[model samples]
Target: MSSDALLHTPLHALHLELGARMVPFAGYSMPVQYPKGLMAEHLHVRAAAGLFDVSHMGQLRLEGPDAAAAFETLVPVDVLGLGLDKQRYGLLLLENGGILDDLMFVNRGEHLFVIVNGACKVADTAHIQARIGQRCAVVPIPEHGLLALQGPKAVDALARVVPGVDKLVFMTGAAFDWNGAALYITRSGYTGEDGFEISVPGPWAESLARALLAQPEVLPIGLGARNSLRLEAGLCLYGNDIDTTTTPVEAGLNWALQKVRRTGGARAGGFAGADKVLAQLDGGAPVQRKRVGLVALERVPVREHTALQSTDGQAIGEVTSGLLAPSVDKPIAMAYVRTEFAAPGTRLNAIVRGKPVPMEVVTMPFTPPRYHRG
Candidate 1:
């Protein structure tokens, strides 16, 4: 690896031992795929269960006398209304309603537990510190490690090792004792499946990972498959699909902004970019570029940054995420297209390698999500 390559998580050595092909991603050396390859790994996770080491993600806690009120000034979500033990997805916004990052906030007892992307951890921490300052205590959980167990059989596989896991519904979390180690397990994941993300101390990560893999339905997956799975599921990949230049309204993520958080309301928590986001909500944004799914007829895989053009040869948008969908058996992609051209079944052309490939806008989650919402 080059010196410019980012650091590795504690499970890096274990990945090497499993014959994984390592690659630099999100400022960390991560396993992009094991010997099974991306397609096989993706199918494995969809059909059975797969374990992923996501320790590079940043986990932090905010606590203070007015933690919820103080934290609301930083993000648009209404944290004060969030019930205990419930997790909500939110976005850190700029003054212009642009997305700084997408994060998950969980009301853990008296404090708030937050998780953000690893690539933007430094900036996110700095932003939080600068905004909240002395109003709240922002503590980084550096000694912790994150793991994801995903797939159709994920719940059953985890229940065998960590008992009582079946009781967890989607977006709920609980403290559990796993193989003599304390872990925080959340009934949530990025793959649009019934899964759990476990946060454990760094030292116990390897042991817990080994135990999960010991299950017959569990296999170790990597970043390559992770990307493909999220793409097929129509999930946004922060920096690519959404970033500081894209607003929540334009990105079709207005659902993340709860009704209570809207402007001109008694329950509204005044946060950054409230004016712009609220205005867009009342009088729809002029340029609503939504993340829509696309199916390409050409066999060639369409990668990111590919230009999307209308059938009449007019440029519409660009592909933010693309891959050969393992489940759909076709080249599928997600692009931010103008709202006028974002309806499902709209015909378009993707310029892949100088050729005009016929494409069609389709509904998201190319495959039906098999999440166990109960």
Candidate 2:
């Protein structure tokens, strides 16, 4: 697509004013970094607070008598039992158990509010519409812009703007009035930190972003830092770490699949790809490869698509996402390796630029997550 056709978030002008380096991402022109660079921006978020413009992500509302039942057919999650104000992670799968997209859904009492990856939003929405539109009202809210305020000081900073917002615990959300515009604030984010994702009217986004930036602890962070933070937190990236060819179980996202969808449960095999997915769940079929975390012993950053080899030089797998984790101060990566070699402490070699770099199959979230449970 041409540059002129690129979509701009409501905060695009503010990003320019803040001296951010804008780049095209997920069909929108967004900030990749600021003058502070990726390293500093990342560390700042770990210590204080950072504001992010994630308006490009798709937001929609689903309602009707059979909304949850209709939704349960598309993804492998217990959406019907979701409590009011509670959110759950979900995976949209193909008939053969391949992943279509991963999303977050919140039960808003009478309806469900969903947030999906920007790159897959168009396809995801159409898929849902074509399959279950008649059962539920699929209302797309394009006029809203999302902003994530993340890190240790996020609550303190936001409390000054929206009093009592700190009352929300992890995976919960509620609506609040801020300067006459209704704001939906969720205690969730992609960075694996204690934070809030605020949805505001497009016209109010810039104002809200500016108000948060005015706080001493809040700074404008770009996608560069967002990626590093999430990687350190062991969170998956949409297109890179996960894609249509990967299954939720193979991607290490089985936690998102509630027991109700597994074997011997009430709603066991009604979802897409149930046969294949349930087989993997019950261990009836062998899982050839699995996602695991790797740590480089050579201080070298192992990047995505790097080949993995066993100690005896036999090819085993490939890296899906890797980086020099700022929080851990070491090179860490996520990869798909043969199941036998996926355990922690298992020795492996990453073929970086044709040279075998030593790495260990380590546990993920090199940095422990700091979500607020209460």
- In terms of lDDT, the best-performing candidate is 2
List runs of model 2 lying over 4 Å from the truth.
Answer: none
For residues 84-135, could you state the per-residue lDDT of candidate 1 as single tens digits? Answer: 8889898998888888899988999778999999988889989999998689
lDDT per prediction? 0.88, 0.92
In angstroms, the error of model 2 at 40 is 0.7
lDDT of 2 by residue, 1-374 (tens): 77799999999999999999999999999999999999999999999999999999999999898999999999988998899899888998889899899999999988899999999999999999989999999999999999999999999999999998999999999999999999999999988899999999999999999999999999899999999899888999988888888888788888888887785767877999988887887899788899998999999999999999999999999999998989899999999999999999999999988999999998887888999999
**Candidate 1, which segments miss by more than 4 Å at Cα?**
1-5
Residue pairs that clash (backbone atoms under 3 angstroms), model 1: none
All candidates: TM-score: 0.96, 0.99
